[model samples]
Target: MRTIIIQKRRQAVFIGVLCVALIGIASPASAAIHIYTIEVDAALSRMEVVARFAAPANAISARSRDAGRFLLDARDCDNGDQISNRGRRLTISGNGIRCLSYAVDLRSAAQADQRNDLLHASNFLVTPTVWMWRPRLGGDDEIRVQFRLPNDVQVSVPWRPIKTTDNAYLLNASPQSGSAIAIFGHFDSSVANIAGTDLRIELLRVAEDIDAAPIVDWIQETAYNITLAYGRFPNPAARIVVFPIGNTPWPSDSPVLFGRVVRDGGETVELLIDSQQPMQSFYEDWTATHELSHMMLPYLRAEQRWIGEGFAQYYQNVLLARAGRYTENYAWQKLYDGLERGRESVPGLSPNAAASGDERNSRMKIYWSGAALALMADVELRQRSHGKESLDTVLDQFQRCCLPSQRTWSGAELFTTFDSFLELPLFMNLYRQYADAAGFPNVRPLLGQLGVAVDDGEVRLRSDTELAEIRAALTAQRYTGGPGK
Candidate 1:
């Protein structure tokens, strides 16, 4: 049997009279039944949901413990729905058995709000949020319900269903392994060309050809790679649902690669792609890969976005390079280019610090420059440990320390995690100089030891001798860590 925990928090009482009048439903009766389901029809741009409940005898009331007015809209309710007024029972029922059901339609623009509210509610914050009702048998009186997505929308990935004895089911979108309401996607080869784990192309205009086969292969490969590079997470049974939605337009405020992490009954990571772009372009696929990496490093908060975005950005390039899409030199060159651009723009600022207030100012030095710093650190570690240890090992260790239930970390914790792996104080100094500081350090000079040369607006290898050594170190067949790590 599968067990799910739902925490309840007190909030302002919902006024049912106003809700019933807005939705135009009758008063609810005691015999009314409650049901919950989600519909994602192509004809409907937004997700439409119906929540049904029976009305009480004297009064009808339909109330949500955590769902907010902004996120949820009540299309209809009954007189059975009543709100508490001044700590006294307020009866708003119309007399007969009321069959009240709430119809909530989700707008595409509201995706971010839905994600934030759902995550916060599931984490016990009790702001307005969405949830699937699960029924218990003869124990606690709880509503049971089933959720449905379009079966015609194919999912290529493989996942095992979570065992449950409850009469109701709680469906959620997540990528963690062994989750109760895990969702997966499959590809339709007739509509899109599949290249290993990457989709060669997909056309959003044609819904008939929407396939997830290519993405499934890619996710499986990525999961395998992560497991091979690092051990399984502490929660081995956690299942992550993979939703391969058609590439959508990039949000004006954020890059196309950005996605949201939702903590509900199950963990969810939504990968939004830009289908209009060329499939082979790095920008097209990097977003999916980068967001998926968050599943392993979700403990990062706004303060530690450097570790989150920087590491993901760095690894995205590294993975693409290892896949033979780009040469190692090209990847390094891209990092150098981003570093130069970041340095020229701002001296000391967190890239995402201003994301909450000013979107433009949020573009700080950390993501690109910090990634460059990580690359340099990786090079140094490989050199010091003679390829016996790598950044992947350090990251895996760090995830174990900070991710899971902790869900947040500081710069000091990051440094301490790295120090534990390398047993060195340099990690502390590096954190202070780059991660915790407000200015750029002489990172290019430090990279000089690896035969990299940084001149005015250019980064290049000092000599072919140095290039060959670095190449050998990176490409050595017998290297301890795998290629992408």
Candidate 2:
């Protein structure tokens, strides 16, 4: 039935082409596209959205167009009105069309009917109206929208009925650029509201520290490092809302101390950092940079959570060292410390076992410990490849191949990809042992190759070769403190 309907519409569009051409293409012709916009006001914790079709006057009716049924693809929470009721609303309006039936992606028929009725009688014609509520939990939300048009004009928005898939909408159609799209509401929040681009963000508050110049400089430096290493912005043109919550008495794990990413509305990335933390210090700045890196790995796809977390951790140090903020020794020391801590947490956990899922126990072993292993793998790979092909290149390739989608890769898949970039398969074999086994593999020997020595829980240089190389790298780069320090 769905295929038949599509075929009929295709045929109708073909026949209507001659009529459309004869009517002249000067006036804006509505295409059979889907149009959607989400508006969010963080101050009030409210949101709204409107999705409708702007078709030509010769289009069909609601019944003919599948009874106005639309798919709601929401993430981060259950797909229903419970979350949407929290200061969120959805409104629909069109000419000569009344909504007949509505269906949410994962919601039951009863729930769908209730929400649909709410929008049916509501005043959706009002601009900047309520669309839908964001779920309370911090994650992502999407809606698979289906609607009807009065005529056979232009279908501008592409219909995406799957919740897991991203919904793309053409936000702008200019003569110069032709067309620009907003993916999964991952539009530029700064300009989304003004342009009705289905992307929005709110600044909760600025950092209390008037001397936030250091933090800002650190952010820019991190961005610069990403570009230098990968030839692209960590989050190119993406919206990042920073909230500076002043000195909190509690620790970093406090709910108020952490930031959140609102995945539902447009790919919104929120960061909440404690101003009390010394922003000038390598520790504090690294935290900020690491969190910010999450914006780039938007989909949380890598089965080895360490790929995301570990890379961010490694880069935080690399960028800081490059910017003369931290010495190469300091950066390597940090990596060494992280590795030891991870090893202690899970004595014999294999990398494969660690990368399997996101369970709490698994996360500790996988996200933290696994991250340390990845760093070791990276260092080994760099040395083997004579620094010509480092982990940065591997990540760049991975980003090109696997990012922006919540696709998971198994341990084997990860190794295969990494092996493709390397001459020897030593790293692959090592990675498999740690990843697939439940026991931890010995990485102390690998660190030896880099001329690093671990003495009674301390990571330091064993000989002049390692010490000289590190010193040279740092001296050549002129290692200093972070920006504005």
Candidate 3:
């Protein structure tokens, strides 16, 4: 059985935070705190938003939907207000209305391509962009969003959960990695301890009786695989939202549908699972491991997305091998095949061009170009420092310096930062050669030197190669955590 920790907060503190009303004090308006109280209906079909600003606001606006699609209907203004119903943003102008109230249709807000399920009266999902509206905030400003729900209702969000209050969270400006999901209603939620991090996981309600134990156990193991990169997991507090999508109903029999890491409010790994599949199959799924590996670095911009995706691709296989999921030879085989695919992708297209242009046509290039660079850097670091340095140590240092970063980073900036961590600058040099240069990185010669031989399309490992030691050190397990613990 999976462990479930029911969190409790003092009612007094909760009421105190909610009771922070408009004091009408003669204080600096910017210095006052803004409060947003959200009341979820008993049926969980809709929600009422009441935003109370600390002082009179110059203007209030709703987050615009993508492609000029309007999702919010603003009505019932308290004070003499001017409402501008632009398809994207909802601008409200009023001097008398201190608090704004609006009704949000939950079903309409929950409609998203990834959400693939019909909105039920008891269960639905949404992101903050759907209904949240507030005054513009400066650098030093913050907003408090509190949720009021019925006894059976619960809320799961990517924001930092407030320990002192019930159903409340704190939100700040962040680089969104797609819209972070917020589940409102009943679900199977649990907290697992993995490498000193408390990962809160919520499995949404499904028709089938989804066994929480094996699912959670798989999650714990996958997260532990990421710890092989460093001594601990990347983020101390991250959320994992699991949605059961039933069995594959095909020949693959893969236990996971898909998984993605969203860094909007906070770090969240959303996974789609096949509930009917056997528990043992999930241990072999790489989606969760790949998604979790993305947290090793901060969110990068779209043009530099290869850096994030490539690092993730490289780490997933390496970490899985270290975790005993794959033998050392099998791991090398997978890596060799992946690098070959990347090399064979659309010729004469630089990684940046492939990424910023039609990525679907150049998916392999975008995904593996970075992996090739990672492998090259790892080998170089290992050889230069005589086994004292590697990508693992560099990433560990990076975690110590900057991680769970709130802003977006470019490839150049990230490479420069990596170079700073090393005694000999290395990352930018690789970037210069491969990022904008046509053709994939030529790592075949380096692989041959590392003793990875492909005979009749079958990878054969040899021990007499010059860089065999470095290759061994690349995927060697550094952590003592055993499998199936």
Candidate 4:
């Protein structure tokens, strides 16, 4: 009966189209061609979006939560059809409509400060979710967005750049961990080359004066640090957004206040920094290094966040040491302290449970359990292959096969995939022993075997232990090019 109904509906639609064609009426054009002309005002706080659809669209929407509130007006550009604004989505239903235009007040939707810091200077930082509203397209289809910016106003976005013009980009589906930031204001922008990756860096405008060269150098150094894992950086094109929070009253003496890796439309490393801090302080801070380390793996599921965070935490210390920012002893000491914190955060909870449980107090456990396992895996791989196979080699293989992925990955799946890169299975064994059944993967025994002795929280490195060579090799600068690494 359902098949018969579908057939009748199809026949009626075909007959209607045939009658329209016989009467010299043409069918609507295909919906694959979408062009968005985004106009930014001279003040850089308002955006007018004119989305031209090839055919009438049934649904059009913005992507961010509460983004609909900023829509000042929405109407069909051709026949003035009514458009509905419901939360983050906009709905349009009309015949033979080709254009939809909307105006958004970017100042209201822009984030004044990042990471809960209220004292920073008021600057415009609007993500793409706040301003871009268009018809949804298929996975294979892409939208061409052209920005018409006023003079003295610059824009920064994470979309792929189109070569013919400076302000046009191609937008496609992405694994949106968070909103990809779009900066439209007076800000410093430049490109830095790391291996073959051309990293676009945007430094937000602030009251305090900042030296751009040193910050670029610091970013370059961090990128080089990540290349120690593999010969090249993970993504060919990534973005870095720097928000200055130094003028604000913050207690930390460190240069970087906070950093996070947001894999939205593209991979973006957002760094909140103290611009007043000296150049050396920027290089000394591990926030950028840790954030960049996250790019080595695809975005994991929320329940499997331990693996992502742990891998980053482990790599931060090791990579910083390789970059010569941290002494070998200091790196080991930090790792030991971190693993100890993980072990004590929730005594009975497993890594998976800790990640899924209340994050208020179990944050340490969620961050470090995977780090402990990473250390075990690295040490075991190095021991088995006699310096040929380490965590770096396994990750190299993983990156070559699957990276810049568009989907979320479970921890079990990630580990099983990693296990496929080796002669013997190693990652799943570690996951099985610790992921759900452990307080923490007991790394104390492994530490002792690696000759990382901690006396009163001070790491003492010894050369005579069984796995001492592997410990040194993990932090040693193997890929030496570009900067300190």
Candidate 5:
């Protein structure tokens, strides 16, 4: 099962490959190797990066597609030729350049980052999209970035770590889901080994003198909780960045305030938390679980974001119930309440429209519309296979074939891929019926059949219904059998 990466994130994969083939200049395929060595200053104020290409390259630039993001003070390493044009693209000579160097004014970049100013410790974050400049890696192409850091300083990057080497990582092609961040200096970091996976955890230092032990423990526990999904976490080596923005201008009630899974160079879960809260509060917050669950699928297109958000929303409660944090009745009640909110919000917008609509108006619809679809598909799959098939098993098969896909996918594409793992198609039918309709996915009757009854805005679960066992199985935790854990 080779990883299949469709295009539309960075330089569009097909176009890039075609460009490589056209702009041959007779360069060998092996000449595509790029080695970037970066040295960080002790003050966390600046970085000096040197990129050495195996063969001369004509065009080399940062991976960020956004305008106004460019490397600073770039120059040819061989000669003192400066890269004067600073409009995002970096090229030395029309002929080609073998070695290039650049300097990063880290303090400025960190200041530009909204949350970095809140980090009052020895650490500061400047997203790598600003500093990591290199050529496009095509077939068999690779880039190795080695970091030379001061003592007591640790670097956290969204790239695959080279186990044998220190402070080195391999950056391959990725969906570039959001700009992946790079943290430098004295950030508290560690590796949490859970379910045969090694998750790198970076806890950003904040104003308060917080202990990192309990917070890391809570993260490890949360990761373990997600393992109950289909027996293990999705990505084997994912990065978790914990930003502790204590009671500041941006205030949030949640212990884990906000969490997002970004798959730039690799999958990284960024969690914003209020460190003043007790450890138990973190466990109780659904933010971390919701974010972690996002990794179970590929990055969906921004227009079809409901699929990702809804799937995560659906799993957050179900996984919580399976982990015993939420009782089955409570989970059903939560789902029922969420569906009501979604159905009531954005009167004429469909799930697709809601997902692409203004966040201020379509929040509930965007979140729960997909949840409704997930629930429908899960129940249908179970009913079709007589409890032998489920969203969990389908996702498990997907992980075996394609879990961390390197490209953004349409809602139809994602569902079609999932349907491939079954005897009959399931997700696309649901998609076609409700995706563009100017109404929320109608699942109320289905809920009734599944033994979910609502009385006076409260959910009551009944076991005597036709689909009672399947309803029960939805929240029941299955044994983590076999090798995944």
Candidate 6:
């Protein structure tokens, strides 16, 4: 990480720094606060932005990965010097400049992809990567963006809301797992406070006019499901984006066509729903719960995706069973079926290699190897500690200590961190044993001991086994506190 040298200058100090309206008075953290005032036209086709920095910066950039395509114009507000972007970074001809202005073609940016075509005419979707341009942020530095729009026009961003004011957001530097979206125009969005966290949910207006209540309630319920793992959602103020589509360009008739958790400026759960499907199906789908499960862990590297995906895959069923959405037998059967597919996936590929995209043919292995390890660890913790500790408790402590992490971590780092919260080391040992092994993390024996039996090809729960108590407890609801409790 390069240390950001807030380019020192004596001349620009007088222009700003005393009265940042959003920030009362510039403290050390706010001394170099980047301020952006964006004005959107009535038609919402374009954006005109004027930006001011507390001090000179060596260079300013739009953190979005593909900012160049949608940017119409940018110039140094101080000297009228034309500024250009070479990729994501803005190219300034001379020394660091404190003031600069830029413009974004919102409509064109939304039209760049087919997904936005289904969105209502009144509003459009634009990933912040192209629109927001500012100085690169380091630790403690912040950006205050105030949006000025025509009447009835609103802005939704994956950033902390400035409760004291309207249409303003405070953007902080984040690990940024992926690009976050910003919507401009009319939309139905709300905030649900669940388990000590605020989930800012935005249901994009599609042409179908689906009832927002059922969808919004389902999102809130799914997010609440994430809390069953540890009594809280991972990020304090994560965002959820729901776009309803009848026939998506992508293939899938499932209630949830696709879902993902992106940790850009902040964490956001993006779900593409086939709103044409009955609303009841939404409650039964696993994709949203799976995506929300991802919030429990920080973004891991690409190679370690098996751990991230695998853990989410494992928890999705466990949490659902705990929520009573799935019976214990159904959850176990699903886990059994998933593990069988993983075992049958490329036999020679290590979990690490499969996840790193080497074969790309081992999707099941990439998604379930970590789950096998999770189950083993959970059973071992329960058996050894006599019910005192389990995977859930360790994860709960982890969330209290280091969630909403500011940077990415490796599988070893995550496992080791989990071990740190325990009396005896467990995670790293499991990581070393199976992460790079050519074969899967064999949990069939453990499963058998846990009273999960395979009769022919089907899974049957045996309540007579010694470890049946442990198996039952694994999917039992641990938290009695409700959403706001």
The predictions' CA RMSDs to the true structure, in order, are 12.6, 12.9, 6.5, 9.1, 8.4, 5.3
Q: In order, how many clashes per candidate?
A: 48, 51, 0, 0, 0, 2
Q: Candidate 2 on 81-150: residue-level lDDT in tens?
A: 2211111322322332211112232122223333222222211111110122211111122222322322
For residues 1-485, could you state the per-residue lDDT of candidate 1 as single tens digits?
12211100100012232233224322234323344444444532344444444333333232233233323333334332423321111233355333323333333223434432322111111111332322211211223243344554422111112224211232222222221222212223221111212221211122334445544445444433334334443233233333233344445322244455444333444444443444444233555556555556654555666666666677666654554445566656766676665665456454434222344544646466557566767767766777766776777776666454323456566667678877664566776666645555465655565555667746575545443465345422222242223
lDDT of 3 by residue, 1-485 (tens): 12211111232244355765323323345555677777776766677666666677646665545412433445433442435546545554555346666667765566653463633345667777666666766544557778889998889988777666777776655677777888887778887778677778888776535567778778888888898887788887789988876645555546777788888768899987877777878887777889999999999989788889999999988998898887788889989999999999987799999889975779999999999999999999999999899898999988888886778899999889999999889999999988999899999999999999998878998879999988887777665854324
Q: 4 or 5, which is superior by TM-score?
A: 5
- Residue 50 C-alpha lDDT in model 2: 36
TM-score of candidate 2 against the unseen true structure: 0.56
Better lDDT candidate (2, 3)? 3
Q: Any runs in candidate 1 off by more than 4 Å, and if so which?
A: 1-128, 132-206, 218-266, 276-278, 282-284, 348-359, 362-364, 400-402, 454-485
Model 4 RMSD, rounded to 1 decimal: 9.1
lDDT of 3: 0.77
Better of 3 and 4 by lDDT: 4
Per-residue error (Å), model 4, residue 186:
1.8
Q: Against the true structure, what is each candidate's TM-score?
A: 0.56, 0.56, 0.87, 0.86, 0.88, 0.91
Q: Find the candidate with the highest lDDT and give its number.
A: 6
Task: Residues 122-213, candidate 4: write the lDDT tens digits.
Answer: 34577787678866656545576777788777788887666456777767667789987887666779877787777788887765456777
lDDT score for residue 296 of model 3: 96
In order, the Cα lDDT scores of the candidates are 0.43, 0.42, 0.77, 0.78, 0.80, 0.83
